[model samples]
Target: MGWQIAAASAVVVVLAGLTTLALSPLLGRGRPEHGGGPDRDDEILRSTLLVAGVIGVAIAGVAGFLIARRAVAPLGEALARQRRFVADAGHELRTPLTVMHTRAQLIARRMEPQDPALPAMRQLLDDSRVLGEIVDELLASAVLTADPGRGEPIEVRALLDEIARSMAVLAQAREVQISVAGPPGVWVTGSRVALRRALAALVDNALGHTPPGGWVQLAVDVRGEHVVLAVTDSGEGLAGLDPAELTRRFARGPRAADGPGGRRFGLGLALVQEVASAHGGTLTLGPAPTGGARAELVLPIRS
Candidate 1:
């Protein structure tokens, strides 16, 4: 009777093992079975295969993730290096351009007003200045794009005021009324130089696009933990552009070339957007209340 009971228990164990093996293939939890599932050996093979499959899937996932990371790293590094190269090249080119401009200016001053060389010299000087402006813009853009992680605490009000004052001359030349209305001493965490450049670029854009006798207003207001700096130009506003598109690179609005001083517009606002982002800020463009376009730069306040 004891022998009979032992035999029955062994049969039950064998049947249970066979059931697991038979279901393994249907569940896709096993590797290739080397033998039929009716036997105990087949059951062991199925259990081993199931464990191996899980291990294989885990290994594949890890390998795939590593490959993806490796692929992205080089592209990011290349973009950074390219931006640095552009900045360096622009900086180096500025010196020679400045010398050429000076030489042209001197030639124009020395020549008689009616002389044929006078027009040529004047044109050269004008071209040189334009080239210099382009180089400055390129250098600024490259620097801003390459390093969005570089910013320090800055005083917003003073910076905007300073830029406003500096651009006052150009605004005057175009007979455009320019003003700044904002409180002082608002502190923000961003690269001071980059912040200044961003404000100047926006102000310049406004002054450029505002029709002669029109007004360009710059205002900075503290909204909770964010500082909002806005520049408005009273000229033909953006051509029904979606506000979101304004932040895109090279997205020049139709009004860009139509400002007070007959402005040559391209990439100015793009740089402003880039600078804002580099400082972990937001930029927006919309229609001003005075029937023109407005640009706003919102930056986080430094604690």
Candidate 2:
């Protein structure tokens, strides 16, 4: 489009200049020589051609800008619709997944360990729970991508404690101890739901990598003008994997896909990173002191 506009503008300018020159001689030919004959006519022609060229270029530029904007408008609308669809689909799936998980758990409770169907029931329950988590992550990603988060003061310590408590059951089932530690009353500004989901993703990723009987820790603290929420596990730290690469959607480390929790879809860390950025924060990944991976979501402390 740009090239075409330039070409057309060039052609118009050239034609205008040619027409002015062609008319100059005729217009000046019979005029009195003393009345500023051909020389004055030539000056008028040059000035007219120059003005015409400027006007033509200006018009072309304006047309090109409007054309480019029009061309991209539909693409923007399409992307927005796609994000909305993903978010809506994920939200709608949550209820059914919760129902299925509840039913599967109820069946498991009624079945004897020796029953032939017990294992299958347990597997179904696990699958349903994992599926629910995936849906939640999907919704989080869609929301973060589509809209900027509303930053409001959130109680950081309480949030971490809630997450730790909620995830305790899963940690125990995997024989990995999970703990939370933080000072009280520390606050940050961000969307509470988004921040909670980000923390959940970090904890889930940590638990997935930690070995049986290993420990995972969630800690919140204030450092200078920032609030930090860190999730560290007792698993092998990053294993020489690039932290930046792991933050990319669907990018996983070497052991990320080989855990007992089954294969991770690799959206967890990516969602964490997105949430952090939306809240004017940073997500850092590094080796923990205890030889495990440490993921930190750092946000500016709301004054």
Candidate 3:
């Protein structure tokens, strides 16, 4: 609305200036040539036009503001409702998911090694864990939209180690090697949970695109005032891909079609981008020197 009003005022002012220019000659012609004194008629005309232009611009600006507000009012309300719905739904799902995960774990523990249902029970537990993680991510994304929370001193190297360990099983299953490398005790200022999630998303994305026998590396470093955490994979690089489009929600790259799961919803990078923004940081995607994709999350160091 403010932008619209400013634009409208600019247009009105320009038009009024043109109109005054056009009438200047006419006003001057009406002044008596024989008078050596100041031209009262021209002076009155200039003052009147100046006042009229100001008044016209004021009126146009007000009207533009009202119109723009009315146009966007419904859209604003709809977005607010949508955010609330997502946050509420995510909250409601957490408890049930926790219970399901707990039950699956208990059932797995009770099952004998030779039991026919042991494998199925294990799969159920894994599925439940994955679902729980998804729920947490969803909830975080929704809540972060309204409140990004506070920042605190975080051990960047420790966080990277944690992420690498958490993803080790998955990487091993895929025949991919995952490693974390960086100097210890490096610190940054941000929400640890949010940063952890963002880094996890980046690693998960790298692992998904990487093929068997490939390697994924998570490297952290302090460059001046920013702490940089990057994930590089020795898989197919981002050749012929639109990096900007991939960052958009639900947007997928070309490899998405042939992905192991058959076309992903492409929410990982989007979530990473959102988390980066929430921390006043940035996420960058590019081709890694290892002939694969590289994702970098750069954040400010603790002051």
Candidate 4:
């Protein structure tokens, strides 16, 4: 990233210098030189200015490039360290999560139906499985964005239905009803696993804010060449909140501090936005007409 910044600064500097050099003398091109008199001096001055401008532009460009690289070096290092940490953590946790999931299944087999802890255990199993999926996904795609064309075509509506079913457990625990409510036959082209994880993140975030007895909805809307997967919740609306700021990394809403310990501020929203961008799409957040928050993940429809 630092190198990229430096390179961009250098290119901008070069372009500016070239433009000045190419156009400066032309400003007085039609005028005649009177025996190397004042007009000639004007020409000389312009020439001098042109030369000096080039030299100054070159020096400034080099300086700017170096400064930009130095300023952004720490950020580059931080990003590298973060990627390494994610890769290492994903690799290390993959085995344990699989084992945990298998053990949960084993426990489920041994437990009686009437066991009071059955529900919690089942939730644990689901959580472990989802964690494993996330880890596997992180391992497969270590970057901030995903490769949308790496998989076959996906039946989007059916995928959303499955996601709703998977999230039903979480919604039930929260006493919030979650459902897929939209036209069917929606389709897209992307990795099923990646899309599934991103959509699940959207629904999970909605369920987190929705109060018990409230409802969460996943609806699809098609506009031109793009399709929108909108998740809305009947919790408190986004009063006095900036939708753009909330989508930024590490950003949080008003109720962020009051949420569960597992909540990572706006990390989920950030990832979803990244996914949307990768798939030639965008993410929008705003108030829902139903007096709640709405998040829209819009992607290009499969042609």
Best by TM-score: 3
- Candidate 1 global CA lDDT score: 0.74
Backbone clashes in model 2, listed as residue pairs: none
lDDT of each: 0.74, 0.80, 0.79, 0.77
Distance (Å) between predicted and true CA of 61, model 1?
4.8
| Residues 227-251 of candidate 1: C-alpha lDDT, one tens digit per residue | 9999888977765767676666666
Report lDDT (Cα) of residue 212, candidate 2.
91
lDDT computed for candidate 4:
0.77
Cα misplacement distance, residue 239 of candidate 1 (Å): 3.8
Error of 1 at 163 (Å): 1.6
> What would the TM-scores of all predictions be?
0.59, 0.57, 0.70, 0.63
Candidate 4, residues 133-225, lDDT tens digits: the string is 888767555543334465467788888899999899999999999888878887887657777878888788778877799999988888999
lDDT of 2 by residue, 1-303 (tens): 667666666766776677666666666575666676677867767766766677666766776777788779999999899889988899899999999899888889999979999888888988998798778766766765665453557899999999999999999988999998988888876677778888988888788778898999999888999999999999766777788887788886554367533224378788788778867789999999998888889988878
Tell me, by lDDT, which candidate is best.
2
Name the lDDT value of residue 205 in candidate 4: 77
When 1 and 3 are scored with lDDT, the better candidate is 3
Residue range 34-102, candidate 3, lDDT tens digits? 654566655857775986687677778777777778988999899778878887887899899999999
| CA lDDT for candidate 3 | 0.79
